[model samples]
Target: MRHLKGGPEPDKHMLRRELLAVRNGLTTDDVREAATGLAQHALQLPELAHARTVAAYVSVGSEPGTLALLDALRERGVRVLLPALLPDNDLDWGAYAGEGSLARIQHGGRMALFEPVGERLGPDAVTDADVVLLPGLAVDARGMRLGRGGGSYDRVLARLERAGARPTLVVLLYDAEVVERVPEEAHDRPVHAVVTPSGVRRFS
Candidate 1:
């Protein structure tokens, strides 16, 4: 991927900080309303509407909420997969039965994450998903996602590639998180689309 910034470009760390700061300011009501809109708009995507299995994550802190989407998908009889963080920051998959199926986990000093409490499906299980909903701070015009710098989903994407799996990659975010550009690395892969509270944007 090309580093396509115009002027004095900010690195991923700086961009993340700015984005996170804005998110940290959102109120509980703001997050709740956005979560509802996110689920409604995301459910309209043909990729997700027809998918039998979807690999998604639970939202934490001020990140765009995904619980609404997850519950909606489950109610549709879709087999939802959630990730369990491995010791190395790589993700392992598990089925999402419901809200009760998740357990809170604090990865050392990192923020607490709501992860699946079911049987571990191993890292490669993501290859079986028809759609993979990624969590990100922002998605640029190129559909390139700016993750939280954990590199966990990076490993998941690589594993899917090695298995020759072609799942529709989607990221859920707030309307403001859709930006003109975001910093990208050589290993970065653009997502197929991003579903925000406003609507969906696709990339070629």
Candidate 2:
């Protein structure tokens, strides 16, 4: 696969639109097949194997599916923490009890999200996680991730850093989403690995 070269720079907004179009184009069968494969590959990660607590999210729209992995982790007795979006776009933590424990929430004009309906554990709760499964549009060879522009995960990363948390950071995406490079800014940091339906890639 051709990696992106550092030069005049690519338009992130345009790139996002293009990627989203591809994602939205996936058929229901395509998404389900990928989701099953994604769960298989993600569960093989050594980080997850040793993790007692994992911070993850529920997939919405065409995002790479995570429900299978979440259920598997929960069944293993691992503490699975889900996020609830704050008005400021930051996140608060909540424990995932099961499918019955989630509540659909509509934040303004955004699509409804399935959030945990348990006690609000506050933002700092994520610091206790051993692994954090991030949601993104793409990740470059350098492991720098391109998010959906909401900036919620950015704050989460910052909080983890401030607390000196060394949780293994992982992003979930389609195989095509792993590119040679993507646009970057000062605050951007590389993820430790990415899990696709095809397999997993790790970075130093």
Candidate 3:
């Protein structure tokens, strides 16, 4: 910003706006095809193959589709934990039973999110995950993620750290979202890898 010496590298806020705009511009078919491809690639990850538990989220709107992946994981007998947004912007964990168990919740004027309909598992439940599927607008060459400006996942990461849970952290994204640079804060941690429709890119 104005405080930078030469200039500001593209901050996370700016990157998020640009990436989200592109996602919003995609056609229905574009989103659908990408979703299928995403599932195929993600399923191939060895991390997910041996994972007994995974912490993931339901993709909303034009975000890379995750419902397909979620179903596949369940079919594979992986215990998936999904997040429900709390009033304080923290997350509450719950088990993903199936599509029938989800309730669409409209948070204030924000976009509606699909969360598990029953049996809240409390926040610390994420410590049980073998892998954590993060939702982010982009991941840079240095592996720093550009999130949606909500600190919810950041909180999750912090909790995992405090619990000494070393789950493999992964982020799902469209191919173009793998970028060369993105802003980072002191609290930001690099994800272990990024799964794109084209392939999986490991940063760690």
Candidate 4:
């Protein structure tokens, strides 16, 4: 996708309205079923299937399915790393060996996360990553991501750009969460592809 330095500021009110519309449209059972199907497709992706190391997020909110995918990756012998929210609102990645191995760490406000194992690293870790599954509030066909207004992934992905490496960025979303356009900002990062229960699609 062509990189644009700045675009119209996303209409926060409109965005919220759109998000609520999507949220209200789906039942909890619908989300679970979609997530399960998406997880299966993710495991079948050639890159992910053969990847030695992968970077993923621990799902929060009403995003798509991830727990099963994490387990599947582990079963395939892929080294999985999860992002832990840090004190400064930056992200640090660590290995997700298992639930028993994860320690509770403070995250985004009062939220607690299972801290991954080993030394914390930045997005340069994406250099060796075969796959990086991103969490998004919504994603458009152009790969634009509407995050939770945190700008955490944007900052990290920009750092990756400075290092001259672009790992495959995949956004995991429920089918309905995929939209025609998600408002973008000057600092927003674009993903390479989006995966849903139906299948994977190149965003650009």
Candidate with best lDDT = 2
For residues 1-204, write the lDDT of model 1, one tens digit per residue.
122344444588888888899899999999999999999999999998899999999999888899999999999999999999999999998999999999999989989999998899999999999999999988888898999998999999999999999999999988878877888899999999998888888999
lDDT of the candidates, in the order given: 0.90, 0.93, 0.91, 0.74
Candidate 4 structure, TM-score to reference: 0.83
- Model 4 spans > 4 angstroms off: 1-10, 24-28, 103-112, 117-119
- What's the lDDT for residue 164 in model 1? 99
Candidate 1 residue spans exceeding 4 A from truth: 1-8
Candidate 2, overall lDDT?
Answer: 0.93
Angstrom error of the Cα, residue 128, model 4: value is 2.7
lDDT of 3 by residue, 6-105 (tens): 2247856666777889899999899899899999999999999999999999998899999999999999999999999999999999999999999999
**C-alpha RMSD between model 4 and the true structure:** 4.6
> All predictions: root-mean-square deviation over Cα?
2.9, 1.6, 3.9, 4.6
Cα displacement (angstroms), candidate 4, residue 122, comes to: 5.1
The digit string of per-residue lDDT tens for model 2 on 31-88 reads 8889999999999999999899999999998889889999999998999999999999
What TM-score should be assigned to candidate 3?
Answer: 0.95
- In candidate 1, residue 201 scores what lDDT? 85
Which ranges of candidate 2 are over 4 A from the true structure?
Answer: 1-8
- Model 1 residue 114 lDDT score: 96
Q: How much lDDT does candidate 1 score?
A: 0.90
